[model samples]
Target: MRFDISGHYLLLQAFDRTGRKVFGGEWHGDEAFARDTEDPSGVSGERRNIQDLIKTLAASAEPHNAILASDADEEEHQAASDALHQINRELGQLKERLATLPHVTGSWLADHEAFKRRTDIESKLFEAFRSGDLDLQVGPNEIVQWRTWSRQPDFKVLFSMSCVIVPRSHAGQRRRGPAFIQLAAFEKWLCRFAGAATGTEELTPEAQLEIWLREKIKGPKEFSKPVYRAHALEEIPELSARAFDRVWDNVVPKNWKRRGRHGS
Candidate 1:
């Protein structure tokens, strides 16, 4: 599970015990969630750290119990008891800290249902664009506009469409243009839409690499970037070294340790 918060938007994704994705939701807020912090990246890192700690604590009980049940010396027993006590203390603190954060209240759909709804909306938008029924026209600074077929614009469709189609930097500009979108943004969105309709978006470089890493690497494994790159290329011939470097750290599991001279 992960909660990715940025400005007024939050994306939450969750997986079941078998690691199958069960829920995915995107939320929009009237006010920013991280107004007190200037560093969004830092907030993301902190969230991940908290999640890691939760996982670690959840798995620690058996090991600590084993030590207590064994014929260990007094010192060892004392250490295990102290560790369990510390874990409890941390868990209590975590609960209190989490309670202080602003609660998100909204409706959501299951993963499959959400995907179907999104695909249906994108297909309609794509068909409109392809049929030239949208009546696209060039606006200022490479922006594209279309005439609304109905008396009022279909804001719901436009809102859903823009979430996946519009670039984050140009989102504000879109609000100003109202009826406009960036032509520069169209190609990427078009490709994404086509891929979704055809079920090929999962084959993208980023998606492929994420799948590879999760399958090949496991807990406590030493991650050597050079070695991983070589293996990844063998598995995915199209993997770009520069692109891999750019996202390697972000995609790697939190518990993975760097090996050799870079190990920490």
Candidate 2:
């Protein structure tokens, strides 16, 4: 099990007594984390460091007794839930306080200076960090997984923020190899989409490699959107044969596979 935080920013995985994955999730802040990633947030450096501890704990495969593993699983689940709840509550309080301020009306005209301030305030509120990064400070002894958060616009309003984690792992694998494989599959299908034929002919060094789309792409007859890409990849058999060596090289420890397996 692994936690995919802030999209691909971080991943946390845990295993149970029988080497079974127990818990996996993702965490990301609202505006702060997103803006920080695109830009930078010096303030969150200390908080991000907690990720190192989580990585260490997950890699250590100390055999877990049945009861101990169960207890640990329960503890982690409760901890994650409680932390999310606390964040929501804090954001709610902040919203109430901000709402007390008088609402200022501004000009609709873009050239007006008041209009500029009004637009700026609106943008900031939309991109404001609601209940995400701030609530998830690094705990001294535990990994806190953040589930959701909100952003403040104007005063008392609360907006629901959401994103998706694409499932990329195949059965029995706990890494992102599937994502890369999917991309490769898309590349292959894209070639056909652009009327490009696959061949064994030697290519020139100057040939550019990029997924191209034709001006008149008569996509799969059934649908109009990009869902056909998935269908096309599914029809191909070679995807399964594609090795996940790249993923393993980045994630697995050098020592774990080189030496004999360590067991209890």
Number of the top-ranking candidate, with lDDT as the measure? 1
Tell me how candidate 2 scores on lDDT. Answer: 0.27
lDDT of each: 0.45, 0.27
Evaluate residue 21 in candidate 1 and report its C-alpha lDDT on the 0 to 100 scale.
15
- TM-scores, in order shown? 0.27, 0.15
Residue 43's lDDT in candidate 1: 47
> In every candidate, how many clashes are there?
0, 3
Alpha-carbon error at 179 in model 2, in Å? 21
List pairs with backbone clashes in candidate 1: none
lDDT of 1 by residue, 1-264 (tens): 221111011011100100121111231221111122232345446656777787788688668889999999999999999999998889778766665544322321233334444444445554655566432322233323323322233322243222222333344545332233322222223443322132223345654666456555544455577888887777777778876765466556554545552355
Return the TM-score for candidate 2, rounded to 2 decimals: 0.15
lDDT of 1: 0.45
Where is model 2 poorest over a 10-residue stretch in terms of lDDT?
14-23
Residue 90 alpha-carbon offset, candidate 2, angstroms = 41
Query: How many angstroms is residue 95 displaced in model 2 relative to the true structure, after the best TM-score fit?
Result: 29
